[model samples]
Target: MNGAQSLIKTLANCGVDMCFANPGTSEMHFVAALDSVPEMRAVLCLFEGVVTGAADGYGRVAGKPAATLLHLGPGLANGLANLHNARRANTPIVNIVGDHATYHLQYDALLTSDIVGFARPVSAWICESKSAQTVAGDAARAVQAARSAPGGVATLILPADTAWNEAERPAQMLRDIGPAPVSSQAVDDIARLLGNGKKTTFLLRGSALHGAGLEAAGRVQAKTGARLLCDTFAPHSEVGAGRVPVERIPYFAEQIVDFLKGIEQIVLVGAKPPVSFFAYPGKPSWCAPQDCQFSHLAHPHEDAAGALAALADALNAPAQSSIRVPLQLGGLPKGPLNAMSAGQIIAELTPDDAIFAEEAATSGMPLLVTLSTARPHTHLPLTGGSIGQGLPLAVGAALAAPERKVICPHGDGGAAYTMQALWSMAREELDITVVIYANRSYAILNIELQRVGATGAGAKALSMLDLHNPEMNWVKIAEGLGVEASRATTCEEFASQYAAAMQQKGPRLIEVMI
Candidate 1:
């Protein structure tokens, strides 16, 4: 068998069934091999950013790595932004980047560039296959690396010659490894801290913000009178009725400091100490209070859920100590569609078991706060602080869990970064409802300009932040991309359009003029 076939077989055997690809000439052989291996489902993405971001979404939902096929260094560069997001999210992904033939590297062809150098910053593990006989083993190891503790991105650079050459046999599939156990001493220490009666909080992320970890944390909170807070940008979190509610740290440093004001101790669970997204002129970078003592209960690589459960036992938490949020849908607003009205409409209409991918920037914060107590759903945010992740992430999440409806609330400025994802959604017939907040400007940047101490009244600077020379017709754009869409100018219009979209199947878009 050819090396490409061997690699595909190895990936399928190791539980990687889906591949997001935007291929070029160097990857033709690997593309052709997809037909030979019927088990590997190949998903075509128009842009490399969509390819990488979709893989990130799939990993968050599937709890396994999805492969991404890019052309070469340039193509890998095209996908690097979302790869940065994936790295920060600690999502499992196997990047298969194609390179020129081994012998052709000496000539430095037009597409030839430093592939390894570009991959090092975003990848936790990287390997270049030297020969066809070694490609299968390399691919197997790449999967192993991606599925390591807390998951990570593993890049495998494949030369053309190695892909086309014959291999002796397919490599054996590697076994999946579990996360490391949390230390008993660490759990006991956290228990003692909680027993001291000082004001304390549990800062959560990764697995500790959802599922069993969240339940254990709720028990700890009920028993110890401590608060529960999640990171500002969590990769994935399950929320809504019957689940424990977690307050997210505010994005602004000033607001975060206020939120954490009284806390005397912080027990981190798969999260870092609160810090500002950027250094402001007069604000402190660290958001925690000056007297707050930090303690690590569980690292990201350790078993966070297990650690939380053990801590609950140590605290002597009661069996029914978990706090459950009751269903509380807000009433629909009756005026023009501003942030508040829009948030109310969404909270009233969002379906149960939906997957919400948010990139609404400043406009969506109010909506997120409203939906915190809405129906049960899974929330996926932009973990890497990158824009243009919402739509593509919705695509991947829908693909991963076909039974669950995916809802993406995107900002107008950020939506332009990866709009090609709409076409993919239409082609795949995915159940996704995209709500674009058509403010016609980079609202977040405008807020940042003020935060960074930039003075007002400059024509050029204001022009750069505005998107209104000609307003973007999102309805026309969505129709052009083969997806049904509508424009909503008022609260009633938005509620009607959103309800209609949810009732229908396949992909749809609603442009809310706020």
Candidate 2:
């Protein structure tokens, strides 16, 4: 078999059956190999960023790596911002980037750049196949690296000569690397801390926020009177009214400092040490109290659920009764819009089992409290803090759980980053209700300007952050991309449109003019 065929078969063997791609001339042979292999489904993207970001979203919801095929360095560069976000979110992705042939590189082509240098910041593992015989081996390794730990991006650069050349049979199966076990000593330390009855909180994220892990945490919290908080920007949070009710650490440093004021100890479970996302001039980077003792009950790679379960037993906490969920629709807003907002829509229109992909930027802050009342729903925030992740994430979530309604509450500025996802939603018939907050400017950047003390800026300086030039008409944009669209000017209209969109089959877009 040719090297490209071997690589394709290897990825399929590893259970990565879907690929998002934007190819160029250098990838012709790989494209040809893909054509012959009907088992692998390649979804086309107009831009490389869409391809990479879609793969990132797929991994976030699917819990496995998805492949991305891009033209060499320039293409990878175009996708780097989203890749950076993927790296931060730790979503597993296998990037197959096509490069110039060995002989062609000596001629100094315009497309050439330092591919490895560009990939290092985003990829946990990166390699370029030296020969056809090694392509399959590299592909297998890339998959393994991507699937490791909390999941990560792995890039494999392929030269044109290697793609058309003969290679050995592809790896038929992947090695299973189970989640890491928690350290016995760490558990023992945390148990002692909880015994002291001092003011303490258990901070959890990633897998610790869901399933058996969260149940274990609830039991522990119920028995011990310890508080539980999730990281502010977690990729997926298994939350809502009845499901443990974790308080997220405040995004602002001052608020966090106030929250942690008298806390004696902080235990982390599958989460990093709590800190501000950005630094304020006079504030300390770390938000926890200076005297607070820090401990990790379970690291990200460790089996958080197992760790929590074992810790609960060690602490002798009783298993709590199953929580109850109310199966009713919340009341809708009335009258004209008048800044009734995205938070209001989420609180009023969120159906049971709704999945929310929130990339609403600053407009999302109010949603934290209002939607906290919405029971039995899953909320996924932009883990990597990348702007364009929402729509694609909604697509992936809809595809992942077809029975559940996926709601994407997005800011118009951020939505523009990967708006092409609307086309994919239409093509794939994903059950996603995309609600765009049409403020028509990067409102978050305006906040950032003041937060960073950029006051009294000139017109041209301020104009760069505003998007009112043509004032993006999201309704038209969604329709142009083949998705059915509507506009809602008030909270009542938004709630009505959102409910209608949620009940309907296939993709729909709601432009909520906030």
Candidate 3:
């Protein structure tokens, strides 16, 4: 067997079944070996960013790692933005980056560059397979690293010669490593703080913001009267009816400070101290008040659910119970569709168990408030603050949970970054409904321009933030990419098209003109 075949076998044996790839000539052997290994599913993407971003989505839903195949240094560089997002999300991903043949590196080939240098900033672990005999072992180790506590990004550089060379056998499958145990001392300390009369808030993220961890936090709040708030951008959160309701920290620093006005102590569970996404002219970077005390109950790598449950047990909290949100479908506006109307439409139409991937910069915030009382669903936000992850993430979520419907609401400017994901969704016949908020401008940048104290008196500075010089035709773009799409000018038109799209199968797009 060749090294590529052995590596594929090793990955499959280690429970990695999916690979998102955008390969070039250097990765031909690995590409050719895909036919030999029927267990590893190969998904082709047009851009490296989509390849990486899709893996991030799959990892968040699948609770494991998905491998990504990139061509070379330049190819790896193209995918770095999404990899940055993956790292911030703490999603497990194995990046298989192809490199030049071992012998060809001495000649200083045109495509040769520092692959490791580009990978270190985003990767938690990186290794290069020097020979055919070591490639399979390296692949196993890469999966092990990716599946470690809190999960991480692991990069494996494969030379062409090593991939094509003969290998004697595949490596042994590596067993999964569970998250680290929560510290009992930390749990006891948090319980003491709660027992005191001080007003405290629980800041949550990662696993603590969803599933059983959320229930534990709810119990603490029910018994102690403490508040619960999640990070501004969570990798994956359980939301909607019947789940514990947790508000997200506001994106703006001033709003966040106001939100935590009365809180005297903060107990962090798998969450970091709140910080502004960017510094403003006069505002402080830290969101909490200057006098607020901070306490760490559990780190990201620790078992957050267990830690919270222990704290609840110490406080004699009540048993878990259903928490319901009354569905309130606001009156739909009759005129042109704005953010409020768009949010209301989504709140009324979203199905139970749906997956919502959001990147609708400033316009999508209203949906967050509206959908809080909607049907039970999973909400995956842009964890790394990257612009182009929304569509690609929806593609991966649909692939991971085929039985559930997936919805993507994206800004017109951000959608342009990874619109290639729509083509993949069409090719795979994925069940995803994409809603484009076509405001014909980078609305977030306009907000930032004023926040950053930019004196924009000239037309040129304003033009840089506007997209109206030639407005994007999303319907045609979706049709060209093999997905059926329509344009909606008013709330009624948007509601009609959205209802029809949700009822149908496969990929569809609705461009909301606002």
- Which regions of candidate 1 are displaced past 4 Å? none
TM-score for all models, in order of appearance? 0.98, 0.95, 0.98
Candidate RMSDs in order: 1.0, 1.9, 1.1
Candidate 3, 150-235: lDDT as tens digits: 89999999999989999978887787676788778888888888878998999998888778888898888888888888988988
Model 3: pairs clashing at backbone N, Cα or C within 3 Å? none
List ranges where model 3 is wrong by over 4 Å. 321-324
Scored against the true structure, residue 288 in model 2 reaches a CA lDDT of 90
What is the model-wide C-alpha lDDT for candidate 1?
A: 0.91
Which predicted model would earn the best lDDT? 1
Clashes of each: 0, 1, 0
Sort order, lDDT high to low: 1, 3, 2
Error at 399, model 3, angstroms: 0.8
Better model by TM-score, 2 or 3?
A: 3
